[model samples]
Target: MSHLHIPDGVLPVWLWVAGWVATLAAVTVAGRVAERVDVRRRVPLLAVVSALMLVAMSSEIVPIAYHINLTVVGGVLLGPALSIIASFIVEVVLALLGHGGITVLGLNTLIIAGEMVLGWALFRGLVNLAGRSRVRLIAFVATVVTLAVTTTALVGIVAIGGSGATARESGALDPATLRFDNPFSRGVFSLGLFSGGEDHGHAEREQHTVEAVEDEQGPDETGLSVGRFAAVIYTLGPIGWAIEALLTAWLLGYVAQVRPGLIWGGHWQRSGGRMPGDEGTVN
Candidate 1:
């Protein structure tokens, strides 16, 4: 759910470039902070978390319109700093696999990193407020935070892409004038996964017609106006965000109760200066 499928060159250049810069800055800060910490000891664990993210995101449940990327769980376990780096690495690999666009990598990374940081913060705060034994509370807070962050980022992306216009105005963009039909067709193509095979051939033919018209018009003239584009993006992305949050909350909550040691900073361990047998018993 944290992954963005927006293609390159779809969004205005400024918005795309700005997102890239912000993500770079964030990565730099996270890297520096991680360097001072015992990251070497966590390399194997980080690899595992990255692998989990890759697999989780790959298994798409068609009806839900999105996949579960539970890097937030990793964030809660490894802390936000390390999770940021881990998410960045995973996103890069996913992009190479054609799961997302290269130009939008920065924006995608920032969104996921936001989820990681917010989830960790929520986890830490809930553990402190309700006491560590209230495992359900911790999971609930983490899930809520993850949803909120992901939703906010989706809204931000819509706003940035200038898709917030009303339907009439959004439809004003002539499909016949587009440079590439991919940008205009992305929304429908994405939704096609949920629609089943009934209209598949028809949709492809229509998409082809639109692409032909757009090809004649050249690149600059075909995309929707900023307001209209933003509106479309805002309209579609939130549902997936909510589903992911609920799933993450339930899964994490169960894990917290069954294996409390996984709830970072909750169960004191020998390596962190606590006694060996004290593991699993919260402070």
Candidate 2:
């Protein structure tokens, strides 16, 4: 859920640079895992799955900032190793569309990757516990747990990042930019999307582009208190989680019935648009 929209200048160069380093390290780890698993076959599958996640994240409902992440969905289908790369790809693509800071791409990757991994972890266990009898319940619980962990991680990122921000930068820092009270908002996910206050009521924005919210030079230093920021995050987090959990669960249940192999371990196939396994194919 942590797709923080703060433009390039808001974050210190050191911090964003560090983010890139960490992100690259993660990608390296993902690469190692993929090589062991079978890079020749999985790369094509990874691209297709990553593109799907990109579409879901990009399709923002302007009225409410709700966009499907399908982070867990990727984890379930692609496994944690490939999902990290997939999440990073989604973040980079979103930056190209001007939805987020180019400098902070690595950080956003870390946040989203956390979601993908946790969702995979929970679902891997829960799917076993539920067996084949209660697929929906297991999915619902896994998604909710994933959201909770990711959202809480969002707060930690904001708190830490905000603390490292330039305190004396001469710019207006508006906390109201969050717009959490608005009925039609991005909801908890917006915690990941918030930047130096962009007018979000433009519900009809073309899906292909995102207006750059950060200043070309840098973002204004945030003056939002950690206590207040955390308070708002906690307040809005549960609402968004519950809503997304239901949606995610429904999608998982549907997928389970149609392509059981996608959810559980199945023979990996290389065909794009479909994942064929011993159980069945998902197309």
User: Which of the numbered candidates is closest to the native, going by highest TM-score?
Assistant: 2
Clashing pairs in 2: 3-192, 4-192, 9-218, 9-219, 10-219, 65-185, 65-186
lDDT of 1 by residue, 1-283 (tens): 5767777766667777998899888889988987665556567666887888898889887765577788667677667777888888888999999988898898889888888878878877777788867765566657656765686676667655744223223345333323222565653432233334233334466577567855776554444465554455456556665666666677677777676566644223316533222365676
Residue by residue across 35-76, what tens digits does model 2's lDDT show? 875466678888998898887777775444556778877887
The runs of at least 3 residues in candidate 2 whose Cα sits more than 4 Å from the true structure, single-residue gaps closed, are: 164-166, 169-222, 267-283
**Native-to-model Cα distance after best TM-score fit, residue 185 in candidate 1, in Å:** 32
Clashing pairs in 1: 162-226, 162-230, 163-229, 163-230, 163-231, 164-227, 164-230, 164-231, 165-227, 178-222
TM values, all candidates: 0.68, 0.73
Root-mean-square deviation (CA) per prediction: 10.0, 13.6
lDDT of each: 0.67, 0.71
